[model samples]
Target: MTPTRARYDAVADFYASGWPDAIDDPASLRLLTLLEPIAGRRILDLACGHGRITRELARRGAAQVVGVDLSAALLERARAAERDNPLGIHYIHADVTTWSTPDQYDAVTCNFGLSDIDDLDAALATAARALRPGGLFVCSLLHPCFPGGPNVSGSWPSGGRYHDEGWWQATGELSSLRRQVGANHRTLATYLNAIRRQGLWLDELSEPEPSRDWASGRPDAARFPVFLVMRWVKATAQP
Candidate 1:
């Protein structure tokens, strides 16, 4: 297994219990808002952890929903939820970077998941291929430009600059999840350029306002964007 998958597998139990079913974080809320009119849309969620957002997609009336992840323990939790709640969300045990499907989807989403994936280009290409022509590819992530303020770790290591893109683990209390599993850091341009390369056109971009509690706690970090939400579209023709 890849380090990312193994690292997360080690922490799957903690993660599965820690996060509530109804997520209220600003980043996730912003992403959900952009996923409107979800009644009957076929959706695929990449790097889906415990099926939180995937369940949300199903709950919001997605016609069919599939969630793919690399963690076996996490997939078990997701499958358990599906068995208990019967949301019809199919959970797949696979990595987003290498997984394939004959079926395409109307919309593809990755909630704060891209940064955790080591092969950003491969993952983006997979997402692109999973989309039907003119379908939507939407995602949210921790803002790369966020220079951390007091107590919080920004998008990169404390010693690392924003332009320094690679893998690093956080040590801050605010970065509980990342501290355990680490994350991949990439520049905004890298993501945009890769999306373009995959024939996914940028449709909308959002830098959501930080929550009052977070802003008050880390004013400096709040000064910069805390989260990024993007919507892209698969073109009818590829380059």
Candidate 2:
């Protein structure tokens, strides 16, 4: 198994348990806002841990929603949810980097999953390929400019802010799960360039604030943006 898969498998339970509450997260809320009027559209949800967003899309009237992730353990939770709720969302156990399909979708979404991908270029390319011309690709990520450090302090060790790449092991409160499931860091330029290389045009960008109810008592969240949401469109001209 790939290191990323193993890491997620190790903490799949924790991740799935916490995902229900993640809708209150600033990024997730923004993504939902951007996905408005999704009825009758087909959506491909990348790195869809436990089908939280996938089920939401299905509930919102998506004609079809396919969620893809690398970890079988996480997929198991997703499948269980599907069985109980029956949203008609399909779950695929495969790495996003190499996964492809002849079936095109109306939109592809990746919620806070880009940073977790080691081969972002490959993943972006695949996302582009999976979409019909003029289709949309929406994704959210930890803002590279101000990736908040450990905890909600929004503070980092000297020079830590500029780290372009490395493994970020979780520490403190939920260190056990965080340590097992680490993330990679990519520069903002890297992400933009990857989209450009895939012939995708930036349609929208947002630095969303956490919901008031969710940010309460979290001073740092109010002070800084924790996530960045972007929408890119597949251009008519192939890159």
Candidate 3:
């Protein structure tokens, strides 16, 4: 769950409040659900904005929860919540790409944060290094293959191919949130290969359907997958 530097900081207000704790979206729900048996676990949430997932992980039984992001304004909101409610979640303001600790985690999670980071390889390495041997890594993302419909822009700009992997802005009429901070458009193979390169092998995957209301309105997008959730595990060290 890492966000780009100044980009995320600029929209701190919109995200600090709007990105809620409860997992309402299918992708979010699937990601959290895959992060099961959370009791007595140490989890690191990368790109954690305003500690939404961090707070939830602590509430759900993560013994030690750490949230890291580069947005100070968002961390302020998260810290304020901690002060008010005391969730014991530690929030760090740092770029996930450069941040590292000798401490490892039982699980590492990033929710819709991969594309936000400018350097995909560095971000994956950050997540990989945070995990213990065979530790779990769960995440959610916008479907790579989704050629968005109606006002929503697909993974790439219109007239561009899915193979065109690079940072692109969303001009979708309904995608106001993404318009504020554009995302990197990578191919499905790129994401899979990158994770594998980081030694995080795929374990399971989910392509969740969009909400009925949303699908009903955007039939073109409805015909294709909208959200993706993936569970991966760090391969045990080779002897």
Candidate 4:
């Protein structure tokens, strides 16, 4: 198994149980709001942990939804949810960086997963190939410019270089509920360039804040962007 898969497998249940609260967070709410009118669209959800957004898409009227992830343990949780709720959502055990299907989807989404993928280019290419011409790709990620690291100051430490790749462990009050995971930190230009290389066109970008209740406690978070949401569309014809 890939190291990322193993790491997620180790914390699958914990991650799933705690992440659901994020569904109500502003970034998530904005993503769902942006999806708008999914009555008959087919969606491919990448790195879909526990199928929270996958099941939500199906519930919101997506004609068909398929979720792919590297961790079988997480997919198992997703499957259990499907069994009980019956959203007709299909869960696949696969690596997002290399997985492909004979079929294409109307839309592809990855919620807070891009930064976690080791092979960003391959993953973008896979998403582009998985979409029909003119289909949409939407994703959210930890903001590259201000990714929270060891410091709680809400600022990149003065004179400290932003490392592009590393293993990060969560600590303090939330330590038990989180895991030390591998992550890639790319600049805004790197992400935009990757999307362009995959033949996807940028359509929208959003930096959403946490909800009032959550932000109230961490006021410093409001000063700098925490997450980034982007919407891209494939071209009708390759150049």
Per candidate, the number of residue pairs that clash is 0, 0, 3, 0
Q: Give the TM-score of candidate 4.
A: 0.88
lDDT of 4 by residue, 1-239 (tens): 44254458888867888777336877777777767767799999998988989988988899999999988898899999899879899998888887778899999999888877778999999999999999999998767776343333221322444644433443423224323564555678888999989999998999888677755655655567877888899999978
- lDDT-wise, the better of 3 and 4 is 3
lDDT of 3: 0.89
Residue by residue across 1-239, what tens digits does model 1's lDDT show? 44244567899889988876887888898888887879899999998989999998888999999999988888899999899999989988888888889999999999989988888989999999999999999999999887777768888888878899999988887767888888888999998998889999999999999889978877777888889999999999856
Write down the RMSD of all candidates, one decimal each. 1.8, 2.7, 2.2, 2.9
Task: Give the Å shift of residue 44 in candidate 1.
Answer: 0.3
What stretches of model 1 exceed 4 Å from their correct place? 1-5
Instruction: Give Cα distance to truth, residue 199, candidate 1, Å.
Output: 0.2
Candidates in order, TM-scores: namely: 0.95, 0.88, 0.95, 0.88
Predicted candidate 3 versus true structure: per-residue lDDT over 1-239, tens digit per residue? 45455687789988866777776877887888999988899999998988888888888888999998888888899999999999789988888888888899999999999988888899899999999998999988999999998898888888799899999899999887788899999999999999989988899999989989888888887998889899999999853
Candidate 3 ranges with C-alpha deviation above 4 Å = 1-5
lDDT of 1 at 136: 93
lDDT for residue 146 in candidate 3, whole number 0-100: 92
- Give the candidate number with the greatest TM-score: 3
Please identify which of the two predictions, 2 or 3, would achieve the higher lDDT against the true structure.
3
TM-score of 1: 0.95
